[model samples]
Target: MDIVISIASKIAESLVTPIGREFGYLIYYDTNMKDLKDELKQLFEMKDRVQESVKAAKRNGEVINYDVQSWQTSVDKLIQKVLHFEEEVSMKRRCLYRWNISRKATKITQDVLYLQKEGTFNNVAHPAPPPMIWSTFKEGFKDFKSRMTHVNRVTEVLKNEEVRMIGICGMGGCG
Candidate 1:
């Protein structure tokens, strides 16, 4: 009986630690994409639920069943998916930033051409203008904040358990 209890305790520890570590990692991961972040947050909540269920099962000295294992496997797969999505988004954003910089450089060149055509600069020795890359990065941050705010509002509404149904009272043709 003592040996059985010891083995059960060991099993419980093994099961709980990996789930806890995964949960910790997921919570700590920084994601800029609002939808993906929200999905990770939801997964974190699910991890809590699974942890509780595991605890209850352990308290009863019951072996973890196949269904529980399957659920954990699914959660693990979801975490992997989220990580992959994050990497993909990050790469895309980097590409977008580079593209924006190139576009801005072209626009600046066009402005220079227009100024030359208009004879705006009388002096040929003029100081070079400061880079606009910082402004572009700031715009990206603003965009991210706007998206995060919208996602947060929607998440809050959906998470409110009391609000079972939502109605959109807007012009039908406008939508």
Candidate 2:
């Protein structure tokens, strides 16, 4: 009797879970859509603020951070998804349709909330590092004798007032 009851209960539970989840989807359809729309509006506001920062940073010749740029890209893609979902959900006709749409709306609502949280970037950008700049000093010299002569020569040449151009030409590209 105990073994039979355990097997029956397991089978019953497996059947009820999906049905209950679908029912919940139906029940929460309107609420989820409203929350999704509200959250998306807030996300848009954040997007605008971030975009303004990007614009200002560009004006000041600053390079936007990689993560900030990536976030904006994700926002652009999500915009398309939201537009399509909103249009599709507006004409709710069938129970199955609402069930699936509600599920998607719930997922999108969560996504929108996540993006809104991520949009709070403290620093959008910074001045770009100068071109061809290197940190040879920090790493230290591997061959001090060979490299130091070249370094000292270049430094000495740079200090000379009369030398207007430097052309360190050598066989096998020693410079």
Candidate 3:
């Protein structure tokens, strides 16, 4: 009986740890996409605001008196450009997030299977870390480090994409 219990505990430990990590990945993917979805919504709102601004600029009599056709043309072009850039960025971000999630899920599943073979199957039963939980490479966090790195890269790309859009708009306004 003691021998059986000992083997069972060992098997449980081996199975649980990997399971824990995989479950963590699943939670992270869900939370991360939801966060990104929120950002996309904000971007959409900003796009609407930009459109409104263009409309208001077109309707202002004094502005039209000063540079009517040119101003309207510039505003329309700028609005279109900004919107196009934003749409491209949003699409790219969404696609990258999806790809990362699918990749993470697969990796975690494999890890779980591997751990089951080794013993701690139930360790990953809990929700995973939040999207922004940056783990140190040396912290022994396992398969998640790679996925986290991918998430960070996507974040950076989104940041740069936003910056690019803002810079273009700023320059257009000045010109």
What is the C-alpha lDDT profile of model 1 across 55-148, one tens digit per residue? 6666755566555565566666656655664465456545445444333333333433332243322221223356566432433343366557
Q: How far is candidate 3 from the true structure (C-alpha RMSD, Å)?
A: 30.7
What TM-score against the true fold does each predicted structure earn?
0.32, 0.68, 0.25
Model 3: per-residue Cα lDDT over 18-57, one tens digit each: 8886666555766644554454455445445544554565
User: After superposition, which runs of candidate 3 have C-alpha atoms over 4 Å from their true positions?
Assistant: 1-27, 61-99, 102-175
Can you write out model 2's per-residue Cα lDDT over 1-175, one digit (the tens) per residue?
A: 9999999999999999989988999998889878888998899999999999999999988999999999999999999999888788777669899889989998998888888888889999999877896654565446658768997999999999999999876663343
Clash pairs (backbone) in predicted model 1? none
**How does each model score on lDDT?**
0.52, 0.88, 0.49
Q: Which clashing pairs does model 2 show?
A: none
- As a TM-score, model 1 comes out at 0.32
| Most TM-score-accurate candidate | 2
Task: Identify the candidate with maximal lDDT.
Answer: 2
Worst lDDT run of 10 residues, candidate 3, spans: 166-175
**Candidate 2 at residue 125, lDDT?**
100
